[model samples]
Target: MFADRAHAAPARQDPSLGSTDDPERGDVPGWVLITLMTAGLVVLIWALAGPALTNLFEQAIARVSGL
Candidate 1:
């Protein structure tokens, strides 16, 4: 109920994060690391595969254009 919620004390934030910051916000660093690692993997894979993929595409286009 609205009345019960209004009467209850507010939840406490984590002490190390400063008083205004929520404890649950800690997961952002982990998510950022995961996103950075995924991006690095994508770049590495593209670097390794880009020339082969381009060659394959050119061959396919050449066959079609010849037809």
Candidate 2:
């Protein structure tokens, strides 16, 4: 009795589909923002650790030179 109702319905068009007009497609903006944020984080880390790194290098140099 269920054999007559087993036919598939026609495919419907989607209204929310994206257009293909833009040349710079994909996640370019997201990648650029991520790179900028990573660079900012690196700069911040260097700023916070610069003095300690300098001190450590100075101590290493002094120890090596026997001064």
Candidate 3:
């Protein structure tokens, strides 16, 4: 009875679940955008903090040399 019912049901193909011909074509631009944004953020942070870091390093050197 189970085998008869299984054979009577038709196979359905879902259009939304179909495979794409160019899967990797969309990813390259997104990765490039992410990399550029990350680099820009790093440059901005370094630009903002560079002066204070330099002063701190100079102060540490002065204290160490005096000892």
Candidate 4:
């Protein structure tokens, strides 16, 4: 005695492999991914530049003081 009409229709399988039946599982949105990548790049750049800048400043001071 199933009365639901929606369930009466046959379910269709997608031709595309690895595709989700639901839209929510798709890859992260473009803007969100870009923001995340930008944040990561900024952090990486700062980490690499910090020590190099400190060393350069120390060398400059030493040269000026004849040390």
Candidate that would win on lDDT: 1
Q: What TM-score, computed on C-alpha atoms, does each candidate reach?
A: 0.60, 0.60, 0.57, 0.40
- Which lDDT tens digits does candidate 4 get at residues 1-67? 5678666977677667545667866566887999999999999998999999999999999999999
Clashes of each: 0, 0, 0, 0
Error of 1 at 48 (Å): 0.3
Candidate 1 lDDT (Cα, whole model)? Answer: 0.87
Query: Each candidate's lDDT (Cα)?
Result: 0.87, 0.86, 0.85, 0.85
TM-score of 4: 0.40
Write down the TM-score for model 2.
Answer: 0.60
Q: Of the pair 1 and 4, which is ahead by TM-score? A: 1
Q: What are the RMSD figures for all models against the true structure?
A: 9.3, 9.3, 9.9, 6.8
**Candidate 3 colliding pairs:** none
Point out where model 3 deviates above 4 Å.
1-26
Instruction: Give Cα distance to truth, residue 65, candidate 1, Å.
Output: 0.9
lDDT of 1 by residue, 1-67 (tens): 7899998998887777675455755677889999999999999999999999999999999999994
**Residues 1-67, model 3: lDDT tens digits:** 7889887967666767764455754677889999999999999999999999999999999999994
Model 2 Cα RMSD, Å?
A: 9.3
